[model samples]
Target: MTTAPFEFFELHVLRATRISPGFARVTLGGAGLGRLASGGRDQRIKLFLPRPGQQEVAVPVGAGTEWWPAWQRMDADERAVMRTYTIREQRRAPDELDIDFALHGDTGPACSWALTARPGDPATVLGPVEEDNGGVDFRPPTDADSVLVCGDATALPAVAGILAALPPGMPARVWIDVEHAADRQELPTKADAEITWLCRDVPPGPGGPRGATVDGQPAGAKHPMLEAMRAAAVPGGAPYAWLAGEAGCVKALRRHLVNDRGVDRRRVTFTGYWRRGTSEDDLIRQAIAAAA
Candidate 1:
């Protein structure tokens, strides 16, 4: 049998702390966490949170790669609330992993769990066991002379990790959108990065700020993040762009970068963290349908 790159690991909530106005950092520790090898920049993971009143996550952990089908067969209400998140940092000295949750004061299960996750609380995580795994999205090509990273609050953990992993003094233009000025974080990077932080005075609705559309310009839309990107200039040489966060924004940004900005589509890596007014379950269904 071939070795699987990802596997389920039981994660215990060692502690939760308010790292910023918009983020809650949850430190998870468990016996097998040493096997969870994170590739650093934009390392993604499937986080399984127990529903209210449940003692632990309800996923079929022993099923390995077949766990998805097994999970869907379980009762929806009783099953674990699956959400995608980034690994902010992984330390093996004591086998601990830090995950940052962007709190929007919404009714989302992940947000609710993060707010009240207590020490010793149990959850499940499907994370990478290999360093060079598909879970990591940020991959700047060798020939790329500069980097452009854009995302909303949901992508902060990835942005921070990407900047930290950049070669020393490499040019990096980063734009991040947060709901409030207080949410701004000091991202330490050795990449000579010029980061622009945008704070939305009022977000339209739940998922995130309404961002650019397919045309790269939504008529009468007040997208500060897109406008900021348009106003700024990128490096002349080949540039690798990594964009994520709200589906609308990522779509719009990717369009602008490829169509308007003339960046090659192959050079851009884009992902939609979430769609406005859509649940992760719905997105999962759409993904499955599309794949079918």
Candidate 2:
């Protein structure tokens, strides 16, 4: 079941559905699910997927502190594939976990598995057992007067979760980047938030889209997410910002908010979901190096 902060649960696929042009929703349910608790708002979990030709994912469950080292020592072709993802939603009564996968058309192992995952497909997830665990990252101070959120398709689930959890009527400025306009989905929020969806597929002619300018350059920049944030007028007086998505883009957004917009560095929460050009295998290699 649960061991204070984190624990492992043997899970299986209940269903997999393509909800958008670039997203897939996979529901998981199994034993010990009753002990799994989600901290909501950008809850993170490590999903263990089986390697090709394997029936079930192989991981050292309940290894606790030794989980990482033990996993590293396992045969690469036999061990489970580990990937980080945000909890889209968690339900009870029947006890089910929902995870949204950003489909990359087979580039990512998780994405590839999700595309063809069948009901009863075995998997494992290392998740939190308590409500106040450290996995949830969207933490806004009590004194924050406004909120700013920016992300691409990879961060959509976390962004949506943050918006949904925000206090009623809290002013929020949100910008979401997607590859296609059809990828936009309904994000329900009670906050006084202005949400902007930028589709890179749509060309922003000449001067820029909507006549906006980024750092004296055309507003319709190559990476519209960064350009839009740089040009937008944010509210003053104790604002907290949350940024995620591409590594370079998140870095630039954080820099813009802190150095250029005067937002306190401590108040901003930023995470890089992925790098622009790096493959998933590259990340695996990097993780192995770091662990070593």
Error of 2 at 57 (Å): 0.7
Considering every candidate listed, which one attains the maximal TM-score? 2
Which RMSD does model 2 reach against the true structure?
Answer: 3.2
Model 1: lowest-lDDT 10 consecutive positions:
211-220
The C-alpha TM-scores of every prediction are 0.90, 0.92
The global Cα lDDT (0 to 1) of model 1 is 0.84
TM-score of model 2 relative to the true fold? 0.92
Predicted candidate 1 versus true structure: per-residue lDDT over 167-240, tens digit per residue: 99889988887776677777888997988777654434444445422223221245556777887799748999
Name the regions of candidate 2 deviating beyond 4 angstroms.
1-4, 203-219
Q: Residue 96 in model 1: shift from native, Å? A: 1.1
- CA displacement after TM-score superposition, residue 121 of candidate 2 (Å): 0.9
